[model samples]
Target: MLIIATYDVCTTTAAGRKRLRRVAKVCESIGQRVQHSVFECTVTDMQFEELERKLLAEIDQTKDNLRFYRITEPVDLRVKQYGCFRAIDFNAPLIV
Candidate 1:
């Protein structure tokens, strides 16, 4: 299934900054970064479970937030970019 994952980790302290980087890295491993804190991931059931576990371990329950929206229905995603908005096609074949 396709998942839209987003997170916000407090960066006011050193620990928070570290947590933010860790969280981002986890997401990056399973998905592509659409924004600084947003990612689009296509994961299986087992992979999704592991992703959640890793993210939970890196976040502060009281200070950080994470959200995952499962995209089950088809919807239109349009962009109106003036510059530097290089959108990635998650469904396209990756050319190395």
Candidate 2:
């Protein structure tokens, strides 16, 4: 499944900044960043569970906002994109 993870971490404090970096690191390990605070992750059910757990641990519920969106299959039909930033096609064969 494809998971879209987005986060808004309060950066008014040093701790908040640190949490933001930690959150980004976790997402980067499993997915490609689509925007400054948005990531596109392709993972299995088990991986999603673990990812969610890690994210939940890094965020402060009182100060941060986190979300996960599961994109149904036939993703091309569900997601539309424009501009120069083209997302990688996970199903395509790797040339390098």
Candidate 3:
């Protein structure tokens, strides 16, 4: 399955991107940040749960927020139509 995660730093700061990177890494090769703070992950239900937990752990409720949408398959096409991410292969190595 695929999950589209969109997030924002309510109070922008250098720490925001750092925290976001930490969270993004937890998803392993299944996740990638398409925009500054938004991410997309493709994984099984179990992996997705792990990713969500990791993201929540890194977030500062006082300073950051996220929204997630899940879809099974065809995630690349969906992203292309929305003009957000270029078609991405989630199986690729982590960009970090």
Candidate 4:
């Protein structure tokens, strides 16, 4: 499945800033960043669970906001793109 992860971590304090970086790192490990605070991840059920768990550990519930959007199959019908920032097609053949 395709997961869209978005986060907003308070950066008013040193610890909050650290949490922000940690959260970004967790998302970066499993997905492609489409925006400064948004990521597109293609992961299995188990992987999704683990990813959520790890993110939960890094964020301070009192200060940060995190969200996940599950994009179902037939993604082409669900997502529309514009401009120059093209998203990677996970199903495409690898060239490297």
lDDT of 2 by residue, 40-64 (tens): 9999999999999999999999999
Model 3 bad stretches (over 4 Å) = 10-18, 27-29, 72-77, 82-85, 90-96
Candidate 3 structure lDDT: 0.70
Q: Say which candidate scores most in lDDT.
A: 2
Report residue 23 deviation for candidate 3 (angstroms).
2.9
Q: Model 3 over residues 7-87: C-alpha lDDT tens digits?
A: 665446788878767656654356776666566777778987877787788888788887788875565456454565475
Writing each residue's lDDT as its tens digit, candidate 1 over 30-68 gives 998878898888889999999999999999989999999
Model 1, which residues run further than 4 Å from truth?
A: 75-86, 93-96
Residue pairs that clash (backbone atoms under 3 angstroms), model 3: none
Q: Model 3: how large is the Cα RMSD against the reference? A: 5.1
Number of clashing residue pairs in every model?
0, 0, 0, 0
What tens-digit string does per-residue lDDT give for candidate 4 at 1-96? 999999999999999999999999999999999999999999999999999999999999998999999999899999998988999998899998
Candidate 1, clashing residue pairs? none
CA displacement after TM-score superposition, residue 77 of candidate 4 (Å): 0.4
How much lDDT does candidate 1 score? 0.86
Ranking of candidates on lDDT, top first = 2, 4, 1, 3
CA-only RMSD, every prediction: 2.7, 0.8, 5.1, 0.9
The segments of candidate 4 whose C-alpha lies over 4 angstroms from its true place after superposition are none
Model 2 residue runs over 4 Å out of place are: none
